[model samples]
Target: MNRDTLKNWQSRIDALSLRERAFLLLTAGLILGYFLYLLLIQPTWQALHQGRAELESLQTRLTALEIRSRDLASGRATPEQERLDRIAALQTQLAERESRLQARLGGILAPQQAAQLLQSILAQTRGLQLRQLHSHAGAPLFNRGSAATAAGPAVGRYNLTLEMEGGYDATRRFLQQVEQLPWTLFWDSLEYEVKDHPDAMIKLNLYTLGHS
Candidate 1:
């Protein structure tokens, strides 16, 4: 059903006037751009806010507990030995929490490695001309601390946007190859314009997450 629908749309697009095709492409681009912003950016912002809240909550709670411990220690009302034991117990609790909080999330895809992989894939796709490539930093979903001290945790998603010009088959093959890559790539937006006939312009925005 989807393939037939796509064929129908392709035929319809092929039959449209150049100006109408351009307008359609523009509309599609706008829609896809908005979709990408919602998919890639909004979720990250939400996760970041949640992560900050969680970390801050943890921090505040620990602070409050430490302050209380100190107050009990400074007050002669509590025995020194008991206060020391309480402080030691709190330190152990903190260590255990930190160790558990660093739980592994998922696979890691380094920014440099991702870029290199993209370049290699594009090179293999004959007749595809890479026009532009851009990178964006990722926001951590949660804090990832030392692997030595605690369990290795997952990192954030690193983003890349690429623009290329190629024949339909080449562009299609390139996209397919990217999909086959081992990394966890999220295809946020894809804009393929065929106004110029056999050769088309393609804009691709994708993000890959880091490892465990």
Candidate 2:
């Protein structure tokens, strides 16, 4: 049956006009081309487009990395510049510390000032019977030659001996007031004797910095 059908169709095609045959051939070619485009050509074109887009993205990333690398190279600091920056920072810190030291020194007392202050303290101690009071000259604890020169400042220690007779409460109040002074005072020794009247002998060392 299939062979008969093919023979009939072939006879019909053989009887067709040449123009009609050419038209049919053209139509079949167009259909074959369309199928080929759908199966192979369209897929290849889409793949190529996607590949081009990916390549463009990769190129953009590469370009950005190159720019960053160049910037880093240009902005890199030399070792000498880094060292200079550190030195400047250290100098600033040193200046600040010196300022603080000067401020602290301002609160201290000089030899003459300390003598006057001690006199004032003695006057303020009410109900304190003075036995003896002695004040020695101040001497530098550091280099004597540098202290004589006006390069910076020098630290000095002054000795003071205070002997007084008073009750326990009055002596304690006096000591508290002495402690509240702005200057730094060091208690070297203290001797006390209890009898009908209590008496106290105290030796103190005072520290001061020379501004002159």
Candidate 3:
């Protein structure tokens, strides 16, 4: 039937014992308490747990930041440490420069070895006649004993002189080969004169540096 009619019938019941009424009331109270826990107390408990977790995470981050700040305040590098760092940086730069120099310098060789290479290169030139070839080791560019500590390396200069007879094109090719040698060579002086009809005489002075 209608809800009002059911309520009226329930109210008309008057045969319940006091113990039965007490049990019914206790059961109603327990049911109401369960509903209250589900609607309110459980949500509150979960919110508290979530807030505690968030607080712990924030505390951990704050502790790390505090330690970093303390280190920044008291762990500044000393002058000696800065000096050592600068020296290390300079050494690294020097190493890179040295590598580049070696590449450009080609190969390191003694004066005699460089002269032999040059002689071989000249011998390969077609339509060119070699009159004379000479090579000699010269003095160092600077006094190594006094400047050794200040300079990076000791370099000694070597001299080479050549006299040849050939056409201009052949002589140019010969010079190009010398320039393309595996070791570094520097041109000091070059003199050429038209001798007879088709041939010319050339005198060349070249300098090279070697590390000691």
Candidate 4:
């Protein structure tokens, strides 16, 4: 080779081995590696992490919902149980009312027998010939207690006043007979007088009270 050509070749070879060139190549390689990490590896890792977080949140929500569903299922009531509860409540109320009614009636008569008490009373007095039966013009009321003294329940007292002409013994017998009334009956007053031009006849005032 010519001396000038060989010298040019040696200069080119030396330039390739220089520190500046090496530094430039290393910098370029480092930049390419950084871009690859940002574009591919970093995005993949971030997506994976995000997916994991979302899965965990979904699992937590599902567990909470399942627990709530289980609680609701356990607390659910059957139709029969609800009906029984309602029936029990009604029975308790009916029993309380029945007890109150029995107490009010003095526990004297059964349900079926209670209805016939007034009829039985009237039937007993059918044979007695009433001369002048004067029912007091007032409310039909009576006391629930004995003697019809208006001591117990005065708002429901039943008073039956009457004037009759009979013998003293017959009047006494009639008063005694009325004591067999079903509910209750008692004489409050009994006034007697001798009738004019009567063959041993007496006018009697009879006041009685009945309770039903």
RMSD in Å for all candidates = 34.3, 16.6, 13.7, 24.9
Residue pairs with clashing backbones, model 1? 107-210, 107-211, 108-210, 108-211, 109-210
Model 1 over residues 107-138: C-alpha lDDT tens digits? 44566688888988999889898999998777
**Tens digit of per-residue lDDT, candidate 3, span 68-159:** 77756786555676677777667566555544554545465566676788778778988788799888778865543322424466566888
Q: Which stretches of candidate 3 lie over 4 Å from their true place?
A: 1-109, 147-154
lDDT of 4 by residue, 1-212 (tens): 99999999778757785787788779999999999999999999999999999999999999988877776688754567667777666656555544454356652333233224433443444333445544443353421322222233333334455555545555566566555545444446666665653313333333333233
Model 2 poorest 10 in a row by lDDT: 142-151
**Which stretches of model 1 miss by more than 4 angstroms?**
1-106, 143-154
Top candidate when judged by lDDT against the true structure: 1
In model 2, where do residues sit more than 4 Å from their true spots?
1-103, 144-153, 198-212
Ranking by lDDT: 1, 3, 2, 4
lDDT of each: 0.77, 0.68, 0.76, 0.54
> Arrange candidates by TM-score, highest first: which order?
3, 1, 2, 4
Model 4 lDDT-worst window of ten: 142-151
Which prediction has more favorable TM-score, 1 or 3? 3
